[model samples]
Target: MEINRRDFITKMSAIAALSVLPSSFVAAMGNEKVEKAKPKYPTLKCDVVVVGAGPGGVPAAIAAARQGAKVILLEEDNMPGGAPVDMYVPFICGGPRVGVFQEMIQVLNAKHTIGGRTCETFGKTGSDGKNHWWMPGSYAEVIYQLLEKEENITLMCAAPVVGVKVKTSGNRNQVTGVRIMRNGDYQDIDAAVTIDATGNGLIADMAGCEYMFGSEAKSDYNEPVGIEVADGKVQPCTWMLISERIKRNAILPIDKLKGSSAVEDNLNRWVKADDKEDMIRRDAGIYLHWGRTVYCKDTRDPLLLAQAQQEALERLQENLEIWHEAGYAVHLAPKLGVREVRRIKGEYVLTANDLIAGTMHDDVIAHAHYSFDVWGMKIPEEMKHIGPYGIPYRSILPTKTEGLLTAGRIISATRIAHSSLRVQPICSNIGMAAGTAAAMSALNQTGLRSIDIKQLQDRLASMGLFDGLKKK
Candidate 1:
């Protein structure tokens, strides 16, 4: 502690040396740098290229592959399951009958994750008595694997598609392929047909399709209550968690992070508030009830992220301690729940009215659920859950994107309707439609508009999407 000029000079010299050496080179100086290793093989390609590895993209990729087309499923993360494996989103709906979706369930009954496909919950009865469903999780990975291992399908993990280029045909536009972003490099994927299952509608939007966002005000698309308009108020995104193999079977008890103001105390709390009219019923593991929740502020804009990170950690720990005292060993979830962001507007804009009215389309291809959920612009500090809705094949087929089709939350729907139809079962149904539709589109080499609806319907019926509620 009493070292003087000699030691100080040596210490300053070391510091100066480190400051001059490039960061990575400094590590190499002390055998700390990790040498980059090259892959044994080169890049791969496919006929169909799908971006995003979310629940929606998984099945769409599979459907495309099963259709005898070479396919590539690209996921940004190294792993595949989107919300379940990454965001810990629970619940999968949209199924009212028997099909591969159901069969996939029967196969995954043992593991918490179906066949290691990300999923949650045991079987739950539905308002539609005919359906018994579980919220699928890593199950998407199972689905991804099943598709990728097929002779025709390939998977590109850790690749994110950031750019899109569209080619035009006679009055119809086609997506020739996508340019995937991998760090500083761009990966080009060329294909005849592209499925825009990027969850937030990146592909479809880039393809020059029309789109909208946020819930409509009560005066717009008339619901059971009134017409709702979607402005920029998006649903709150979930920093979700999905932890498993717990020591106790009880759910992690987290209500009010210890010293935070209670719901009653926060009469005008800016941190956590929601629409008073929104339904807050508990569905899946998430507390669907409306009221107070954590609202992490942009409290550290002038400071370092480390400080903000510490504050957030403190809040979480404070909440966790309360549960631990109550005899529940709470596990931090592996992923966060992603509620919303970026849905591509396609040839059609699906409105809540379209779902509520159950608009029959000559191009009808897929069906959805009853929940019309919205995430923002309410008085309560909670998400507004409406009932489910249905999706039509026409919604996926871009009016202009001839060689492309959209699926899942990005389909042509109003913000309110997208909220309704964006759940898992509905997303899977869209996948079903995409596969069949892709096949149809490929075989005839026609625009999606030219596909015979009668033929599509017949194909769906044959594939058991329209089969009995239970597999025969």
Candidate 2:
């Protein structure tokens, strides 16, 4: 029970499994021999079986289930809140249109859910100048309840999808069902259609979908602003932290540090700005946990990345000392937030050009409005001041795989393109889009590649996707 820094490090090693889960989860598996009787699955078949209940996966499963299709959502983690609950992603930003998203937020909102009353928007997040709003209770319960309340959906936890059962009809190979490793036993679940909202495209790759890894070249996508990405170098992925400010915290606001706290910290920085470089209250919603940390990482060297994470933690701890010096106590969180991972390839790759052009697709299912915000050890001078962008349907469908789709930050887009598209709102929308596509394909008895785009678009519009658009 005694825990010191050494214990913390050891515990972190155990917890690193969260980002990738155990290699045991990734261990190739098939029908394993068992002695006694096997447990029955949720059902022999479902309209859609979405793998991984992350940002996009949850929404996709919900959409399909709502669309009158039987759904089964699988997650390796026990509870289904995804990043919000598992990690201290305490402050969620980068969402727009907010009707459904806001309803979800309101449920998680401290006002309605926890008795903390406020609907205030905080100013620019970090030096990035991105607007963020606050809510309470983490919203994990609210999201899970919504899915559970839906009669058409089934939820499965601690089930790692090993692969899929595929069948080829003509030149197209479609995913018929999935193979999963549940509690050390390998089994199969047959479904009419399947979704690869697994984030890494575990389903898409297994189903033999064409894919790409890392940032795309500017020439490849023809995005005028595309960067020439280098090998062994990514913008870096941050495992973020969220900590709440303790009672009587004295962390200085950027404004107060600048000697300006007469105004509300959140309002002054986020809304009323005398100039673009205006400051907000630094302590607003400050979690006593990991404070002012970045996930910039080197994927090539695990040790190097681990060191970066540690350094970030140290710096954050130093800030906690700052809180203590200011006469407050700091409570650090248990886990870190993830920023980047492997994105799955889709049929039509969304490019940076599509984003800059403010492109809309006839089959546009989701939209994102975030900056070309790349993270790393440092922010390059060239990369700054970018804003929100778009995501297209092509980015969700795999190139050579049918009955499969990807959502969230792992969609098939160039890194720069994904940089903008991977917002929380967009991830939720794509989840809905991919789930609906799988459900519609199953219900209509068509290949995922051949689902009616017009119908899909109309349904999405009905669900409040891409609203306020002149043309959808």
Model 2 lDDT per residue over 1-472, tens place? 0111232233334445354232111112222232122435442678888888877778888888888999888887776756655654544545443424545655554332212223222111111223333322346667777777889988988887765666554335556777676666556677777777665555665555555655555676676665465342345443443333455644433221121112223332331224324432333544212234454443323476567668666655545555455554444433444555556666677776676666777767776665566554333445433434456678787665566677777788777777666667667777888888888888889877788888988888787676523221
lDDT, candidate 1, 336-439, per-residue tens: 34455455555556675676566755666765545555544332222243323346676787765566787767777656666667776677678778866876
Residue 407 error for model 2, in Å?
A: 1.5
Worst 10 residues of 1 by lDDT: 23-32
Q: Cα RMSDs of all predictions?
A: 14.3, 9.9
User: Candidate 2: global Cα-lDDT?
Assistant: 0.58
RMSD of 1: 14.3
TM-score between candidate 2 and the true structure: 0.73
How does residue 288 of candidate 1 score in lDDT? 19
Model 2 stretches with alpha carbons more than 4 Å out: 1-44, 110-137, 168-172, 245-311, 314-317, 320-334, 377-390, 468-472
CA lDDT of 2 in candidate 1?
A: 10
